[model samples]
Target: MNKREDISGFYERIHYLAPERIGADKPHINVFERASCIGAVPFSRRDYYKVTLILGTGRLDYANQSIYIDRPALVFSNPLIPYNWNPDSSDQHGWFCIFNQAFIQQREGLLNHLPMFQIDADKVFFPDADSVDEIAAFFKAMMRENTESYVHKDDILRNYLHLIIHHALKMQPARDYDRDLNAAARITNLFLALLNRQFPVDSRQHELQLRSAKDFAKQLSLHTNHLNRMVKEFTGKTTTEHIAARILLEAHDLLLHTDWPISEIGYRLGFQYPGYFNSFYKKHAGTTPNEVRKQAV
Candidate 1:
C-alpha cells in the first residue's frame, strides 16, 4: 500500500498549529498558511480533498501530471490522485484548506462533478492579477472564520471554499463540457453514483452491498452486458473497471486508516478469505496488502 497522508499525519508532517483538533466526530474543515518546512510535500495519495492558493513559483507533481506554477494559482487536489508540491524557492507563501466528504453535509458528491477536481481538468489555474486580491480575500476570510466564535463557522468556511471554487471556475471559460447527457452517459453516471455509494469503507462489519458490475447493473435495472457496453462506450472504461478502481481506493483507505486485520478488511470488501483479498489487492494495486499495511506501521 502506498502511504496516504491522513489528516493527522499531514498536520504532523507539516507541523500544523492545531493538530489536536482531529477526531471522529470533530473532523471539520481546516485552514492553514504555508509552512516553512524544507523539501516537498510527500508524493503520495491523500485521504481528503485539498485546495491550495499557490502564491509563488512551485512545481506540483500530480501523479504523472507535472504542473509548474509561476504565478498566483489555485490548485485542486482530491484523494484519487497522488500529489506533491515542490516550491521553486524557500520564499513560499500561500494558503490552503483541507476538507473531505464529511464536511459537505448536503453535497456529499459535489466534488466529483466539479471541473477543477476532475482528473483530466486543468488542475492549475492562474487567476487574473486583478482577481488575485479577490481570491486571496476569500482565503483570508476563511482564516478569520476558522478561529471565530460564530455558531455557523463551518457554514462560513464552506461558503468561502465555494467562493474559491467559483472563482477558479470563472477563471476558466466554459469548455465543451456542458451538454445534455445521452442515455448511455446518463446510465454511466447513475452506475458511478451507485458504485460510489458503497465506498470509503470504514468498518469490518460494513461489507460492501454492491461488489461487481453485475450487481450494479441489476441494481440499475439494466442487463449486465448493456450496462457494461454503455459504461465502456461513454467512459472509456468497462463497468467492472470502474467498480474495481473504486473498491481498490476503498481498500487503500481502509488498510491505512484503520487497524482492522487484513482478513477482516478482506471480508468486508467481499473477499471471504485473506488469500483472495491479498491476490486481488496485488492484482489491482500492484502491491500486497501486507506491504501497504507496513507503511502505516
Candidate 2:
C-alpha cells in the first residue's frame, strides 16, 4: 500500500521553496489559486478534505470511476477515498482549498449532513459558464481576503468556504439512496464513522483502540456476524477487510513520514511482536517496513 499523504506533507512537497510558516497554524483552512503549484505532483490518498474548482479540461480518477472533464467542474474529496488528476492540457487553471474537520467544527452538521461531502455521494459537478464565473469570483475574493491583515480573517474565510459548499449543493443532483432512513445503512454509516475517527495517526502515543472487527462490533453494539453482514451488503467488503486496509494505510504513512522504529510502529498498530508486524506487512504489501522507508528516501 502506498503511504497516505497528510496536509503538512502535501504543503512541503508542493511548496518546496516557500517558508514553513506559509502553511502553518491554520489547521482548519488553506486555500490556493495557482494551478502550477498544485499540479506539480499527482496526489494519491490524502488525510484531509478538499474542494477544487477547475477551469480547464482534465481527467479525474476517484475511487472506482474515471471522469473526463471537458467543462468547468466542482470536485470534492474526503479522507476515505483516493483520487488524482491528469490534466489534458498544461493550461490548468483553478482554485482549491484543503481543510480539516476541525476548521469547521463550529458549523454544526454542515459537512456531515451535506451530500457533497458524503463518502458515497457523487463528488463531481459540471456547471454552466455563468456559474463557473460566479464561483471564480468567490475564489478571487478569498485570495484577496487572505492577503489582508484583518483580525477576523479566519471567520471571513470560513464563511467563504461555506458559500462554496452551498453553491455546489445547488448544482448537485439529489442522491439515490438515503442512509439515514435505513437501519442497515445507518449502521454501516456509523461503522464507517467509527473507523474514520481513528485516522491520520499523528503521534506514536496515539494508539488505535479498535484493531479488529470484534472490537468495532463491540463499540457499535452489534454482533460480529451482524457487523460483517452489514458491511458486506453495503460496501461489498467484509468488516475485517476494511479494518485491515485502513491499518495498512496508516502503517504506510507512519513508515514513510516518521522516524519511529519498526517495533514502536508495530506496537502502536496493535501488534504484540515485531515479527508479527513484519509478516503482516510482507503478506499484504509485498515488502518489509525498512524497504518501504528506504524506497521513500
Candidate 3:
C-alpha cells in the first residue's frame, strides 16, 4: 500500500468529531484507556485538532518527536499541524478533552489570561500529583455530566473546562526575560505556525500553495530578513532549516511505511522529480530512502 493507505488503519476522532468537522462551535471531552497498541495506530492531523492531555503509562510520539509521560502531563497542537503517537507499551490509562479553537479563544483576554496551557507548543508543563488529580477529577465529572439530559449542560461544561485549563496553567515554568526576547519569540512562533499549516499538501506535484520564508513573512506583515534573523536567534536555526525539517519528516514517513513509488512520493512532497527528492533526502538524512527502510526493519 501507499503512504496514505499505511495510515488508514489508525483511529482518528476530532473534538468528539473528526478534524474536518471541528469548528468554533463544537466541544467535546473524551476519556481513553490505552491498549497496548495505541501508538502503533497511525492517523493524520485531519483526525484531531489537539491533544489536551495524554494520560497513559506508555510513551508517545508527537510532531515526529518522542515524549515519555511518566505522570499526567499536558500536550496540545495548533489546528494547522499534523502529529502522531507511538505508544511504548500497550497498557496505559488516562483521559483527554478536545475542544474547538472557539472554546479557547473565547474572547480577547482569555488566552493571555491562561498562559500555562498555551506556553509554547514545544514546552511541556507538569503539575504536582495533587494538581493532576484535581484536573483529572474535573474531567471525569464533566465527562459524566455531559451525558446527562440536563439543561445548559454544554455551557456549564465549557466553564468547568476553562477553569481546568486556567488551573493547569498555574504550573507553567516562570520565565524571566526582557520584553524584546519575548516579543521576538512570540513573533517567530506565529510564523512557524503559519508555515506548518501549508505543508504535506494533498497534491505535492503542483507548485506549492505556499513556499519561501519571505512569503510567510509577508503574510504575517514582517520583513523577510528580519523574520529570518528572529527565528534563527530564537530557535537556533534558520527559517529554511525548520521548513526543510518538516518536509524531510513527511518524506521519511512516506519512505518507511508507505509503498508509494519513489516518483509519487516525491510528487506528494512538492518535489518535481524523483532525483531531486532523493538528493534532498540524502543531504539532510545522510542516506538513501532504501537505507531508512532497512533501518526500520
Candidate 4:
C-alpha cells in the first residue's frame, strides 16, 4: 500500500482538533502529557473528533507547514482533517483533553460561536497566563464533577466547555490573517474538503468518481485553469495531482486490506476496463495492484 494512502498520512500530514466528546452519564475530561524522553507517538488519523490543549513546548509538522507552540496553546482537530505532531526533545509539557463533536453540538446556540470549527487554525487562541489559569480551573472543575454522580452532567459540561473556549478567544490576541477568504481561495478550500470526504477508497480494482478534477471545478462554479491555480497556490500541488495521488493511495489500501478481485475493484472505482485501471495504477504506484497485494501477504 502506498504510505500516503494510509489514514495516518492523509489526516495528520495536517489535522483538525474538534469539540470535546460528551458522554451519556457525565461528560468526562481526559488529560495526559507527552514527555520529551517518552517521545511523541505518530498519532494516526481517527474517524472521530478530538480537541487538544498543548501547554508544553513541541514542534508540529503537518504537510509543509510547521508551527512551534511553546506557550499554553489550545489546538482543535476535527475528524475531517489529518495531522501529526513531532515533539521537541527539550521543554515538553502539556495536557490533551478530548471529547466528541456531537457532545458540543447538543447546545444549538453555542455551536456557531466555536472559533475552532469555523475554518483553518487562524481562529485558534493562545491564552495569557491568567487566562490559562482560568481555563484550567474550568477544566479542573469539570473533571471533579465527572468523578461524581450527577444529573444533567453532559449538559453542564458542554456549557462549561463552551464558556472555556469562548473565554479563551476573548483573552487571546486577534489573528492578523484575512478571515475574509477570497472567492477563489474559498472555492479551493471547499474543493479540497470535498476531495477529502470521498476518501479511503474501497478497492484497488476501482476508479472512484472516475476521479474527475474538471467535475470538481465545475461544481465550484470556476474555470478549470482558475481552480487549478487556486489549489496550486494554497497547497503547492495541482488539482489533478491531488486527486490522482488520493486515488492511488486508496488503491494501495484496498489491495492490502480487502479480498475483492482486482477486476471488480477497478470497476467499482469507476474504471470501464480493468486493463486501463491496471496500467494507471502501475504507472503511478511503480507496481501493479497484484504485486502490491502479494507483497502485503
Candidate 2 steric clashes: 0
lDDT of 3 at 253: 64
* Clashes per candidate, residues 3 or more apart or on different chains: 1, 0, 3, 28
Worst 10 residues of 1 by lDDT: 173-182
lDDT ranking, best first: 1, 2, 4, 3
After superposition on all C-alphas, the RMSD of every candidate to the true structure, in Å, is: 6.2, 6.4, 5.7, 9.1
The regions of model 2 sitting more than 4 angstroms off are 16-26, 38-40, 174-189, 198-217, 222-297
The per-model lDDT (C-alpha) reads 0.76, 0.76, 0.59, 0.59
Candidate 1 overall Cα lDDT vs. reference? 0.76
What global local distance difference test value does model 3 have? 0.59
Q: Write the per-residue lDDT of candidate 4 for residues 1-297, one digit (tens) a residue.
A: 223322223233435331333333332333333331245645334444444556676766442245787777777665544456776655655544455444444554344334465433443467878877877777666667665567677666666667677775665466522432566556666786677667645335334563687889787777888889888876567898877776676566566556777777677666779998899898987889898779547
- How many residue pairs clash in model 4? 28
Q: How should the candidates be ordered by TM-score, best one leading?
A: 1, 3, 2, 4
Query: What is the alpha-carbon lDDT of model 2 when measured against the actual structure?
Result: 0.76
Best prediction by TM-score: 1
lDDT of 1 by residue, 179-278 (tens): 2247876787788768766655644457888988889888999999999999888768888878777777667766765788888888999998899999
Sequence-dependent TM-score of model 2 = 0.63
